[model samples]
Target: MVIMTATEPATAGTAQTETGTEIETASDAGTAPGPGPGTGSAPGAPAGPVRPVEALLLVDLQSAFVAGGEAVPDAARVLDRSRALLARARAAGALVVHLQNDGAPGTVDEPHTPGWRLHLPVAPGPRETVVRKTGDDGFDGTPLGALLTDAGVEALTLCGVLSEMCVSATARTALARDFRVVLPHDAHATYDVPAAPGIGESVPAALASRAAEWALGDDVEIVARAAEVTFTAARPGCGTGSRAGSRTER
Candidate 1:
């Protein structure tokens, strides 16, 4: 057997110690310091570059979930924020995707029903895409993943209705599929679910949002306000970053 000894390649910043041992010099110390206390990514969020993707996923923002309709609590506010986000994304030429929930015949959100349509506040443009799904996860039985994949989307910003249900489900599934997820705290909403027998009472709208934010943990990046959101294309080494807004700790 030929035993070949390998020597470490010397770097310009390295030096030989007094004992003749190779050592890293002060100039070779390339450590990037971690964020100090109170100066880092949002609570529970992992730190990274956080480059926004071209894709903006507005999940379950159906007409039925708005005010004067089926009513997702505080839908008006959610709509307002979502509308602003849509405008910003559109102006930036970001690809908009609306997720619609389909229900059985004669029920809300049935095919062709008004309830099944995307809300006007954040309606998709003629060129924007709409994906319909029967399950809470938008990718379930739908071409959502294919659409995103074909479009070369790696990171996604999420905002829409039913924070704890459809939005949460889709976000989790997106993350599972290796897509970076971003959550603007002001851009999503949910309803208060009433308590059921043997089940805990439904949390209030505000609480539900907080819970979903916390449940999403460090995987979903939370921005303080929707206005702070930027729909820039994903840059290399981007995922999460130092948050400029408060994180939902629930």
Candidate 2:
């Protein structure tokens, strides 16, 4: 990940998945760095030409996970930061894609159910739209990859719920696709893991989120705040930076 400042050094540790499976990996729990000079614009500032056109990918920001009484710890903060990013991305004419998860029948986020609805209102247009997925990875069986490619999106900022699940899975694929992925430290969250027999005590949501981000390796750009991320309009027909059919990690 691109450290915005010298003060913010990256850190890594072990973490567990939602299924109680443990994975020893790198973690980035520290405050993320901001964009380097000329790489991003301040809120309401014109997008800089030097930065490649970028996109904003909101993964599973559904009401089931981010709203009401069942929300994750610090859900309010995640929502607020995500909302701020959406507003700024819209103002800058950046490509915004909201990945909505369609939970199975009887599940909290069942299709067309209240909990399945998106927490934030979507402004559907050529630049902004929603993609529904049935899995943790947004691009697994969705048109997300095509959409990004058609728009010539090279870099993207990812935010949303279940830091170790949908959010982390999607980010991993985005990185493999060679997208310059930027994950704002405060814009994503997950539920506190329940204590397992002999595994360990209950893990805090904050720490799980950190472990998830850290597992993405060092290809992603971890920013301190959502406001620190900037966007540029997608350059249609310009082609994407994706390494098609290649699974090599950067």
- The Cα error of candidate 2 at residue 13, in Å, is 41
In the range 52-155, model 2's lDDT, one tens digit per residue, is 33788888887778778998888899989998989888988888887877788999987667777777877667887777777899888777888888887877
Write down the TM-score for model 1. 0.70
lDDT of 1: 0.63
Stretches of candidate 1 above 4 Å error? Answer: 1-50, 121-127, 197-202, 233-250
Candidate 1, residues 69-181, lDDT tens digits: the string is 57787788888888887777787777677776776899876755667666643333433556667778887767676666665566678898888889899998877777777
Q: How far does residue 69 in candidate 2 sit from its true spot (Å)? A: 1.0
C-alpha root-mean-square deviation, each candidate = 21.1, 11.3
Q: Which number leads on lDDT? A: 2
Question: Candidate 2: misplaced stretches above 4 Å?
Answer: 6-53, 241-250
